[model samples]
Target: MSTPRNVQQLFDLTGRVALVTGGSRGLGLQMAMALGEAGAKVVISSRKAADLEQAVMTLQDAGIDARWVAADASKPEDINRMVDETMERLGHIDILVNNAGATWGAAAEEYPLEAWDKVMNLNVRGYFLLSQAVAQRSMIPRKQGRIINVASIAGLGGNHPMMRTIAYNTSKGAVINFTRALACEWGHKGIRVNAIAPGFFPSKMTAGTLAAVGEEQMAAHAPLLRLGDDEDLKGATLLFASEAGKHITGQILAVDGGVSAVTGG
Candidate 1:
């Protein structure tokens, strides 16, 4: 391997292409922008075309080469179509961010079976299917790729008194291990797989839960005593997407402001 002469070169992603699921907003968009700003051509996906369009504009406004496709990441056919479209439009994909996810909050007894299935299908199954599609269609064939799964600090444990998202938590636990197993299997093909398990972040997904529990109280649980913001994910995304993390894989990074380390009282 050629050693990078400068620090910036390690994070440089010129000529690379990245696809971020759920990149229409929130954490997905944050990571997408990170890859884009670092010189990658980025394609974002979501279920809504309007959201995707707006996000594309937002990225372009920020001077990033970005585009989008509308598809439900949970559906197998949609996943396949999105992959085909991405490859056709971008020629090849160097990075795939499985950031698309869904969450549900309810007392375990009252939690409908439907909600369980919804969360599991989208959060866990969706990630696997997309990653598999990308690997088979492009990454494996090219013998080069990066897969960054968006896990959560919630996956590491189950002690959040403020939230009752059982399905989401379980799915994320699967994601953490999924990243590890895939990395070990795909390393021989030059495909890197890793995960970023974030803490409480300001987003539509967390709005309801934060409202019920109060954002301040939630933030205080973290050692940093704060919720996540737009830029928190950028550096980590770049690290995994660029040459900076070429030697790193099968790892789960917690961007949770130290929340994962503390247990419930």
Candidate 2:
């Protein structure tokens, strides 16, 4: 018998299905495209129907099988429907990317309770709840799936005095730990859970900061001497979604271009 020619095929995702929350724009859209390019049928969801439709078109134009579902991660009913619809439409969700999140900025002393609750509700609570629903309903029964939580470097360190976003930092910090804890519990079930902590990327969330300070500001603190570009997300995301990362779980992979290593340096 002859050996097959398909060597190094661990990264292929030809028959998988992926569900990405907040996939209408920014990093979520980027990751969705990456997965689609890797041969997975992608389901993108967000609070806005118009944007989700537009994203679907964009992904389709790229020759990728993409669909859209409008749902707010913060709402329990919406979360349930999102998962249900994905399963009903796509048949099964082999991968779940918890990328829908928000941030509010205000000094700690002046931060309002409402703001904190809002941020935590979606970033931490919603992320975990949606993951739980998916795990119990789809992954646990099949005993196979991958969950990737999008976190931030802000979670790895204390608040930067330059920017006051206490609630955002706290929520991201919780997400990192949440990934670790959930991976521990779900690993034995053949479900791999992990997190990706990205550095400064040019997205709607960072538009204000990047415009106000420019690339010089981002490079000053980052060891890479440059802000994150669109292509930076592809490799890290594909690694986790593919067999290349089969042994990795409960890990927080920092794709921040060496920013996490600097400590008051």
Candidate 3:
């Protein structure tokens, strides 16, 4: 027999609380809005208080119950404070989105050591540390939680000759494996760890590169002949956050417009 349907199973998140790092703007804000639209109370955090305030207001104007906290993900103390404050205010955290990241662009031969460390510190070290804090504080005791890390397609394979981001690419690759490793260890604890590797999207991070290369050229390179849109992130994020993905873990779900499938396009 098939499963039965009830009001409780309608992808409703009536009392869930979500903490989204880097939610002040870009893809982080988009994911926060999606979670709020699904009925979860969202806490958005970033290094800039101004941006966080603006984003909180924007979410409120849209009828979502949202709050903001200013913290640098790259700083361990700040990350700890953010998680503690979220718990204090929200009472519990059911979902955590590690969307904070940094990227650097330089040729492999000439990549600055400082640039490499900065990227790795924020993208890799900060990500793991924040996730650890959340897990220990909430997920571990409850024996249930959802963690989503925002990686990139650069992590999947080497970039084309036209683009180069050695540090960013390497950091993302670490994130991908980290997701799998943590999932393996925590699966028995009812904690799900997964990653989203997005393709080209119009975000501040990609703006300079896209402008330099031109959209036409970028689109032509993608198999879908286009970049990712806002809506592309909504469904996947919801799936992992909601019961729809209750059995899935350690997955690297790509939101690319068919870019990862091409061998040589």
> Which digits, one per residue and each the tens of the lDDT, describe model 3 over residues 72-175?
99999999999999999988899999999888878899999999999999999999999899999999999999999999888998886757689999999999
Greater-lDDT candidate between 1 and 2: 1
Question: Cα deviation in Å at residue 145, candidate 1?
Answer: 0.5
Which ten-residue region of model 1 has the weakest summed lDDT? 256-265
lDDT of 3 at 137: 93
lDDT of 1: 0.93
lDDT of each: 0.93, 0.90, 0.90
User: lDDT, candidate 1, residue 28?
Assistant: 97
Sort by lDDT, best first. 1, 2, 3
Q: TM-score per candidate, in order?
A: 0.97, 0.95, 0.96
Candidate 2 lDDT over residue span 86-172, tens digit each = 999978889999999998878799999999999999999999889999998899999999999999999998855566789898899
> To one decimal, what is the Cα RMSD in angstroms of model 1 from the true structure?
1.5
Model 2: what TM-score?
0.95
